[model samples]
Target: MADPLLVVPVREGTATVSLRLFRTATGDRTAVAFSSPLALARVLGPGQRWIRLSAPALRHMVADLGVTGIVLDPAGTLPPRSPATGHDVHRLRVA
Candidate 1:
């Protein structure tokens, strides 16, 4: 399995922080900084104060913040795939 994807963004003055959980075009989930692609582009596409990090790095950053397990896999949450398509796709969790 590959590592979870992550993005980190920091806002000015007010100390705004946003973390987005994303599943790649593939079926794995990653915690990114922006909630959506447009959001990320807004922050990163422009000159913003932020740094991208991997899942492990993110876990380390919040290790001391009393965060427990953050699961990303959608094994039992969604409906099973059809044998006809045979594609391994994980559904995104829409809020």
Candidate 2:
């Protein structure tokens, strides 16, 4: 059988990162989870941005996927808020 391909950032037209759970005794793939880096980190860390993974998931990912690295993407979809604009504000100023 062919090995599964791994990718980061998960480009729009490409496959997303996948986590394959494995059984310790036989080293077989038992389950798979897929998501964007942001989504995965959100799940792993919950409401907190920086947190350590529980021993179990970390072990499973390492054993099953042979993963040794993770890279954070810098792009974010949400735009920053802009300053309020209106001519009425200037007119409302007191002399």
Q: Which predicted model would earn the best lDDT? A: 1
Q: Summarize candidate 1's per-residue lDDT along 1-95 as a digit string, tens digits.
A: 87646446434335655443334444455443443444545433544345566667777765664444344322222334344763323344433
Candidate 1: which stretches are off by over 4 Å?
Answer: 1-5, 11-32, 35-37, 41-48, 68-94
- The local lDDT score (0 to 100) that residue 11 gets in candidate 1 is 40
Q: Write the per-residue lDDT of candidate 2 for residues 62-93, one digit (tens) a residue.
A: 56455333322222222211235311111010
> Could you tell me how far off, in angstroms, the CA of residue 86 lies in candidate 2 after the best superposition?
59
89, model 1: CA deviation in Å?
A: 34
Candidate 2 backbone collisions, by pair: none
lDDT of 1 at 81: 34
lDDT of 2 at 63: 60
Candidate 1: the clashing residue pairs are: 7-32, 7-33
